[model samples]
Target: MLLQMKKKVLFILISVSFYCGLSQSREVDSLKLSLTNSKIHDTIKIKNCLILAGKYGGFSLDSLKKYTLDAIDLSKKNNDYLLDGGYYFMGVYYSEIGEINKAKESYKKALPLVDSISNKKKFGQILSAYANLLSETNELDEKIAYYTRALKIMESIGDQSKIAFTQYNISNVYRLTGVDTLAIDYLQRALISAEASGQKSLKGHILNNLTIFALKNKDLEKANTYLIESENICKETKLNLLCFHTFLQKGRYLDELKKTLEAENAFLTALKNAKKRGAPQDIMLAYTYLGKHYEEAGHAKKAIQNFEKAQEQDPANAERIMSPFSYMSWSRAERELGNYKKSNEYLLKHVKIMDSLNSEKNKKSLAIAEAKYQTVKKDKEIANQQLELKDKASEIQKKKTQNNYMLGTIVFLTIASILLVFLFKQRQKRKNQELLTLKREFQIKTLESLIEGEEKERFRIAKELHDGVNGDLSAIKYKLSSLLEMNNKVIKEAITMIDDSCKQVRAISHNLVPPSLEKFDLVEAADAYCANLNELNPSIEITFQHLGDVVDMSKKAEVNSFRIIQELVTNSLKHADASNINVQISNRNNLIQMTIEDDGKGFDKTNIESSGIGLSNVQSRIDYLQATVDLISNEAGTSYTIEINKETLNGN
Candidate 1:
């Protein structure tokens, strides 16, 4: 029974995660459409392309690579100097797909151009990417060097976010190299930087890594503290990715502490969150860990199931992200279950992966050795060049002494030219700002016009349904009633059916644009709807209460507020599975406040997709009304409070 409960919880987690991914996919689609339809600057287009590429990288390598190359081409065509940024993305794509050699080449291509870029932020970013590539390939010394360089640049620019990120990467390298002391030191530095930056996401990530280090050292108290802190940050910020990693770390810590049931729940939660982010690497890790847990618990069948799932979800670069132990564990489970052939197959796959890893390690070692040799050779060449320069210095000194006055005059003119250029650039910047502001105003007006048109269309549709379709249904019902005088059995049944059909048509018409809303006010309409809902679904109780005198508002405001309430009620019925619900509205001091509470299993707010269309519809209405909505949810129940100012409603 306990195992069944665990499985159920795990399933819920995965479902929630999958829904979140779908929501994100929809957002990505909208962004793509906007990019395609809009006539933006080439630089903005390039940025959007890169953003899309990063979004797709988790699921589609081909798309990632295509967008990355497109960005590079666009940058070159526009002379944007974003070529280094493009190459950095290319490196990231290659690394993610397990093309180590290609990743290395891309990083090398990006490194030299970093210094030429005008954006210090991009320069720091590229340096960090190069460092990450080095770390991935086990070039520890080079990784540390590049990370340090990136950190210095970030510090010089006073970018605390980048400093924290660089420090985190350096700590990861140290941890991978088994330099525990150095890892802990860098992690502490990262924490300080992250705190100073005031970025919840970065702080959460650093805390999660610190928790892992604490777990590795068997410092249970420290691990728990860090995990709790990280989880809190994730919850507060809705950083699903960080939350997923923290859950995974917590599971491991619990497993070590011998709390098997709690550990199982933690792993399942991790799996759920990973699925939400739709990151293949994270999903694969969660599956691998769960499989291991099940195997250790002597559930061979369950273990095999999870292992198969992990394999199915594994990305093209699975060999890089997946642990060899996953394969070994699967083989063991299969063998134990008396599936010798399958066991052997898994064992062979594990062997192949191990061999490939070994080969890659050897290549990396050789590359490092070659790099060292090249560095020494370059040093010697530099020494030779310095000696030659020294030899020519005496002759150059005599010439310099003769042209000193002329050189000074040239320097002064150069300074004056630079000042003129600076002044001209400043004037151009102001003009550009003006243009940008105008563009923004135009976009805002366009959006508002579109929204207004949408509402007008909805009103037209509602009128048509009510006056046209409902009128036809009413005419038919009246005709049927006249025929009911025949008193035949078929005629009586037909009349009853016609009566039922008429009622349904009227109900549909009312739903489109509630008669109470048009004739009365929002509070009365909501109360009537809630009463009807209670009659229809006696299994679930609903109550509506209103306080104070309701103020008059515009037709649009009334319609939107009613629709928002209707959507919330519909959502509760379909998804909340609550047996009881309460709604209250209060009007005072030129403000209207509405609160809805339900006794149902609360959902993960981080997984926005799980909220579905009903919540989205509610949001749209609230946005139209310019109202404020606040939600509080937990496993026990969910509540929402919305406030609308009467002045705002009047203005609308």
Candidate 2:
């Protein structure tokens, strides 16, 4: 309620509102013209489509989606490299339209593409945009991590505009999370960058944010200074959307300064601008803030009326354009007006949303953890039942034979004939048992060969993708860069696609045959894997330790053992909800030992041997190495200990 008075995240609010004015700009017309020209290169058309889509920002989401899709289709048809922006913009559209989950997917699709591209600006924008997703609120660390990464990229590229916004984003997160000191510190840094960038709308937004921070710190004088400056900037720039937000903050600052009539006018102005801008979120916030202004002024009936208008804008969870503060304030207004039922309803909604935001939901972390728990239980139960059924059937068959033998013994006239028949039956049973054993061994050998062949094929494909296809793509990118105008953003964009393709190819190739395993020994590979995993998941820490030095196993054995450790560690990360994981290995004489442990709420181990629950492949690798594993899991954590005898593997 304190720092959160920054109130409601409207990420669709374009920082520099002239971008909003782009809808009517001649540039949009020019881009559209190029897109329709038959003589234009398909690559140029695709770039135009993306630019046109961006130009549609703050104007028509449908047009944005249309152009983005067009770009994606044309890129795929032309085998062009322009796809990340398509996905990124699609993510933005999804987020704006309240498809949070789909937005996340789109963001993920774009994230892997941005890593190899040379445009650090887009990289920063993508990260900053994704961090604004509502689903990211609970992942505090990851949210900051994204902003931090974006900030670094912006700094590297020396893009003051991007840097300012990134700093502002980081500040907003801190403000919402209640680190007021750090929030204000970063906000000040953002103001400096905004000044350096000399963008009026950007400067306005930063000053308005500072006004909120200043008011929160009870510095009315500072708040007054920022509010006035922000208002002047927004008015001068004719930024309607920016005016709505800046005016809203000005209203709050005036309210804090106890300027009743002035505060009322500011709120009304914000509402008028929001209507003109035609964004539901802006309208909703304006109404909510006006309602709060009236409520604090003791106009209970008027407060309820404005609150109702805000609720109308929302339309049964159609959008979350108002903050918990708005809801709570509305609830209080209802209570003051003697509407107990409405008051409680609003209050409950406020509390529920707050709880969800405060929860520790790190993207897919919670779902993976719960799914693993249930899956492991279901698999184990099924496996145990199958084993029991087999045992019962075996017992029944043994009883049937014993009964028949007793009856034959009783009917036998000579004891010697009974003895000869029993002996012959025993000899036949031994031969059958031998045949079954041989069949089982043959099946295991066949499986081993299949797995070995699969690995070899994977290695071959990895080499081809990395050395052949990837290399060729890189060469083309270099050639294009040399031939095209260096100042052309379109060429940079095409290079973006090539870079994305090259990265995608390398990723697939790595998955087929992990470069770490091929390039290093098991110990070094384990360390590299841990490092990579840690990088992928900023929410979790994975540590690797190797102790002792001894001999090397056969290649097959070493690989299988490496895989076992890999599988165990990855499983812990995905399913254990572990904050900390440790992988330790020791080799002495001919014995090698490994222990993978995690500080997570460990799963039930009942009937663990019955079903694999996706651990079947892990078990197969373990079996191949002739290794023994001891698995212990409890509330404290899960630990996997494995031992391998190098001599035994080498001899085999």
Candidate 3:
């Protein structure tokens, strides 16, 4: 009942794009986890986006687009080179959804960015992708040529997985041109490549093609084996597109074995999965295969129904996804049912589409265009390499000429060069010394402000304890003594304890908020403090003297100045074992100078670091006052001459 069955056999049913690998859902989850929640737009995030864009495929086009656009935006933001990857993935997405024209445009944008095929695997994949687009308009020769180029790159790199994809595409083209022997041979080669690739999902797709070829050969046993193996792989990997084809192929196998009911059931299963896949091509394939099934069974009305459904797919997918066989089968069905007019109409339409697709003149033009494109690319590479070689020769010649002419000049400049380097080093050394001095000055200013605040806080706290809590302790002690009997031994001991506590508090308060330093100025304070120290320690004769006109200074300078003199004198009594210490203070031109001479054993200046906190405390106060000390120490005595520039005090 079929008209011209051998001549009207349409091209292969499956049009597989370049499937690099199966990107698992968990991998997508892992990449999303690596991305921070705060949305820092940086290079690290952009790289994650590019990798994630490549990771999304199959049915998750939405996520693929999301990360692709994210990568593009972030690459532009960071001035990076990842926009090419975005365009490449966009082409894949467009092609998958049956947007042939948009996919072509995206591939064109990506072509210039990819490196040469030998250097970058992405270049070969992009080439294969552009070739896939060529298949839509029946540019079969151009498609095969591009796939051959990509195949050579894959083979050179030993990427069996990529080799399998290219082989499968090339075989499909051979099948389209009705070269059955070569098509079958190429499919066998592709099968070997897929098995060597060891990608289980890819092997499954290749096996599906093998199942179709075996069925066409009417080798029922081979077809059964291939069908079972591929079906298992499809189910295991959950490759939706491959699974749909495997199911349709199984229906054909079942029909060959005369299991009519099971064969129809398999076709319906394919239809269900096709609808869920949401690709118009897969849906059309499912319906067309089902229609072919009923046509072979002599069910004219049922075949016509399925064929009509196949033609009613999305118009956007009409050019790329529609099959020529649907109209041919519909014409055959109408002719068998006494509808000559409708039959003629359907047959004419099918002939027109088939002629357009298999036109020899169009194929020649496309082949020439493809040849020109390849030639230009090769010519450009050759030109660039030649230019580089010519530039290198010129550069070498220029260098030789310069060396010959400047031989004497080079000898003359050597001595001058040495002198210039010596002077440069000297200048650098001077600059470094100046930097250290500036750093020291800044450090002194910071410590002066901080230590000055600390001193004031201590004075305030000492005053609070001396004026408030000491008064309360005396009042309590007196009240307790008056209310208790004086003759009781317990009462006497309690009062004695209270007296001891009060004395301790007063001693601490007096040491912190010293009476001389709190109430008198620096000169008066120094004289009074030394006189009180001599009274307290009668064995030591410590004298204090002052000279020069008093200069106005801030409270910080006054407090710190007195503290420095006090600390130096105290150090002589504690560590110096000084029996006779004399301290003198003089002021002139906003500069105050102090001299402390002790008749005690002087300490090693190197060992000053190991001395107690006494000298360090003095040094801190010295920095606060913007002062320096010159020490002349020996076994007989130690003398400190400290000078303070009152004008240098800041935030005093």
- lDDT (Cα, tens digit) per residue for candidate 2, span 1-652: 3232232233444322212333445566777788878999998787777777765554556677898899899988886466886787788777665677888798788878876457677777878878766433446556666888888888988988788887888788766655679888988898898889775666777788787777777888988888889878876866566787788888888898789999999999988987875666667778888889999999988888998898797687622446787788888989997889989999998897687656633333554355458779999999999998998899999999999899887777577778899999999999999999898678678658866987888789989999999999999999988967667888888899999898779766865677777776778777887887776677998898988995366666667777788778778867788999999989998789999999998887885555343677787777666678898999999998888887766334
Candidate 2: C-alpha lDDT: 0.75
Query: What TM-score does prediction 3 earn?
Result: 0.50
Off by over 4 Å in 3: 1-26, 30-36, 39-56, 60-67, 117-119, 135-145, 298-301, 315-321, 335-340, 354-652
**Clash pairs for candidate 2:** 81-497
Tens digit of lDDT per residue, candidate 1, span 1-652?
1111111121112112211332444566765665676577778767667766655543455676787798899899998556765777687666654466787788788777766346666666667766665543556567767777878888888987678777877777656545679888987998898789775666776787777778778899999999989889877866456667778888888888878899899999989977875655667778888887888778889889987787677546555556778888888999989999999998988898889768866765666577678889999999999999996998999899879978999999999999999999999999999999798667556545665686677678877867887788678768877876777788778768867776666666677667788789888898998988887788999999999876567776777777777777777888888999888889899888888889988778888685663366677667656689999888777888999988866335
Q: After superposition, how far is residue 305 of candidate 3 from its true place, in Å?
A: 3.2
- TM-scores of the candidates are 0.48, 0.49, 0.50
Candidate number that wins on TM-score, 2 or 3: 3
lDDT of 3: 0.72
| Model 3 Cα lDDT, one tens digit per residue, 1-652 | 0111111111111112232233333365656776665665566666667666654454445666787788778778876566677787777667666566998898899889767844546677777768866752356557777888988988888888778777777766656555668877887888888888676665666676777778878898998888888888877867565577778889989999878889999999888877765656667777887887888789989998887787687655453445567778788999989899999987887787788667844675566577669889999999999998997899999998899779868876987899899999999999999999899888887787677677778778788887888888888878878867657777677778888777667655665657766676878877877877776788999998888897456766777777777778878988888789999998888778899999998888877867662487778887767679999888899999998876676544
How much is the lDDT of residue 146 in candidate 1? 79
Clashing pairs in 3: none
